[model samples]
Target: MEIIEWWPKIDPTAKEWLVTHNGEAVAPDVLTKIVAAGGSLTSDAWWIGEEGPDGFYLSDEAIDWIEATANGEKA
Candidate 1:
């Protein structure tokens, strides 16, 4: 699924956490939801990737999507 399509399906808390954390590793539960929604956890090209000890991080695309969502854009 597209990130925009799955963005809303994520828990509200997860959204808040991700937005607040920005470039940091996402919470495990949130990461699970993202993966289940078909998000890429291995492709740095998408800006989302799994770093060995650092965990999962969102790229500019994810961040931009969140920001647009927050601004009331409909995925």
Candidate 2:
């Protein structure tokens, strides 16, 4: 599913973290929420910029999407 479709279903903490951290690596708990909300880390390039022992980084597209969404715009 598109991030927009499932964005509202993610936990408030996760949403806040995303907004606050922006380009930082996404925490595991927040990643869990994204998966639970129908987002994919591996299946789509839109979700991940890089992944390794460090953690997941949101793609530029994903970051922009979140920013736009947080700003009350249709991403």
Candidate 3:
């Protein structure tokens, strides 16, 4: 599966715009409106990488962060 980052808007109550293939989306709410108005999917390069990382080199802090996020604990 591809890694995609979904960034919520600053207002926290607006629509979400999808940035394909892990692209950064500033002002995602506005971007979502624009994309919908344009009626198309505008995205950057689609990176086809190898399999996802197997946590082989994940540090203790990384593991903790992942676990916390998995449990829906806010930072």
Candidate 4:
């Protein structure tokens, strides 16, 4: 699955969380659904970084696929 394919499967609050904390470490469960839907940590969409004692952190691509989708672009 691609980034576009996984975006909609993500929860609304999860989307907000990613936007609000674009480069921060998040709870594993925070991205559970996303990963399950085939969101990639190594793809242009995001990357898995140092694992904190708390959990893992992720940084996504510069292009905001979520916003693009919201703006009526083809995902």
Those runs of model 4 whose alpha carbons end farther than 4 Å from true positions after fitting are 40-54, 59-75
Residue pairs with clashing backbones, model 2: none
Instruction: Report how far residue 4 has shifted in candidate 2, in Å.
Output: 1.1
lDDT, candidate 4, 1-75, per-residue tens: 565577678888877776666666765676787787777765554444556776666534423554455567764
Task: Name the runs in model 2 displaced over 4 angstroms.
Answer: none
> What lDDT does each candidate get?
0.71, 0.84, 0.31, 0.63
Query: Could you estimate the TM-score for every candidate?
Result: 0.68, 0.83, 0.27, 0.54
Models sorted by lDDT, best on top = 2, 1, 4, 3
Error of 1 at 17 (Å): 1.2
Compared with the true structure, model 1 gives a TM-score of 0.68
Residues 1-75, candidate 2, lDDT per residue (tens digit)?
A: 667766799989999999999988888999899889988776764556888678888888989998998898987
Predicted structure 2, TM vs. truth: 0.83
Which one is best on lDDT?
2
Tens digit per residue, CA lDDT, model 1, 10-51: 778877887777767787888898777667666445545456
For model 4, the run of ten residues with the poorest summed lDDT = 58-67
**RMSD each, Å:** 2.8, 1.6, 12.4, 4.0
User: Cα deviation in Å at residue 52, candidate 2?
Assistant: 4.2
